[model samples]
Target: MDWSKTKTIFILAFLILDIYLAMEFFELQDKSDYAIIQEATIEERLAAEGIEYPDDLPDDINNSFYITAKSKDFTIEEVAKLKDQTIELPNVNFEEDQSFRTLNMILDKPFPLPDVNTESKITQFLNDNIISGELYHYWYTDEEMNSIICIQSYNSRTIFQSKDDHIGMVVLHLNEDNEIISYEQSMLEQIKEVEEKEAAITALKAIEALYNKNYLSSNSQVVKIEYGYYTHSPLSNQQILAPTWHLTVEKEDEESEDFYVNALEGDVLQLTE
Candidate 1:
């Protein structure tokens, strides 16, 4: 029999098996590395590169993504571009706190006495202006008061005015997705029928009081407000389709009127006025 030839064949078979096992081990190691990267939170990944999340993020973000914080869809090559770049997740903690406080204030009680009349004014204004949309109540805590009322022009825009003339009013536009698209500050116009000036003053004073008491200043202010028409793209490059507004605010300083001023930096944007 050809014993030597058989022995040579056996040796080749053993060598091939060893090579295959080694290749398998290396492949598994590569997979493990990929898994570790994929499972990491965006914050963790960003922190590795010394980046911090934006302050607007709510605290609850530690456990969840904000409504607008979903990951952008990226191709494999596009994502690969981020391999060495740190990506910061939207800060969710601050946002959660803001949302909690805002929701609590509005849902806690009915509209204030003065606000009832203001609501009527708002309704009439909408009707007269031929603005088509549903109106709802939105409440939030401002610098001076525990609750501030805003008229949500459903599937449209929301308007929050100060009873006083100081702070003015903010108009926030929402997209079909109910996400903020843009916001703007408008001075109360002298309307013969509505007399919104007084109402705006009151709302403003309430907010100012809240601010003085709590040292609440603007965290982010909408600098430029722009609206996306149905004919235009609602979503930004990030694929966020909510109405968009640019905001600019002072991160530091409580006393400076310039501090935390809305729409000052030309960055924070919102819907058109």
Candidate 2:
């Protein structure tokens, strides 16, 4: 056996292995650097355009999925609980599935709401007067409609609704005197999280997506950001909802506008009939 030749062969093999590993390490480092550069570039560009967002933008990755649910039906037994309201359920299918999408009510006497700190008053009213009120959270008031909107939620997450579509919500009508008048409610039932839990984009990424799509206006301030679900299948009987990012932008002397972005795909979403 040639002892010297064997030793030389072993050294050559180890030398080749070391070179390969070093090259792999450098490649990974380069890729990481490129990612950081790309993110920094986005930040700089946004500043240049005068687009303002909150300083505490979330970068945490979360898991979510597509869900399926149907509108809930209101039974005669449920409405019987209301003590001081004239009730109507025009959308109920009593014969078969007993499913409904809307509930209407008119207060027997106008209930006055206070001018200051009306939030606690509203919460008390819901618990005392409405059915399944625990499942909903206060949303916003629509001055044009003269209504106060409360959104239905599940598992600490809210179900989003557009102006055109009324699902999983309660609309409380208010008269000029800040008194309760008539109202309508909609709800969802049999909510099943269907697809596998998938990764969702962060708040920053969603904002970037809106800017890239030209859905965001220049010199606008993002006043609100919310994580919720939106129905992608509006016409289907069993609707499928997607995890969404809702961004509200406000400009001086302009009406605030909402833009929803699909969290998984980074696409700006709009509701269709």
Q: Candidates' TM-scores?
A: 0.28, 0.80
Which pairs of residues collide in model 2? Answer: none
Q: Report the Cα lDDT for candidate 1.
A: 0.30
Please report, as a residue range, the 10-residue window in candidate 2 with the lowest summed lDDT: 91-100
| Overall lDDT per candidate, in order of appearance | 0.30, 0.80
Model 1 Cα RMSD, 1 decimal: 23.1
lDDT of 1 at 26: 97
Candidate 1 per-residue lDDT over residues 126-160, each given as its tens digit:
34221121343333324343323343321333222
Error of 1 at 114 (Å): 13
Runs off by more than 4 Å, candidate 2: 1-36, 58-61, 89-100, 271-273
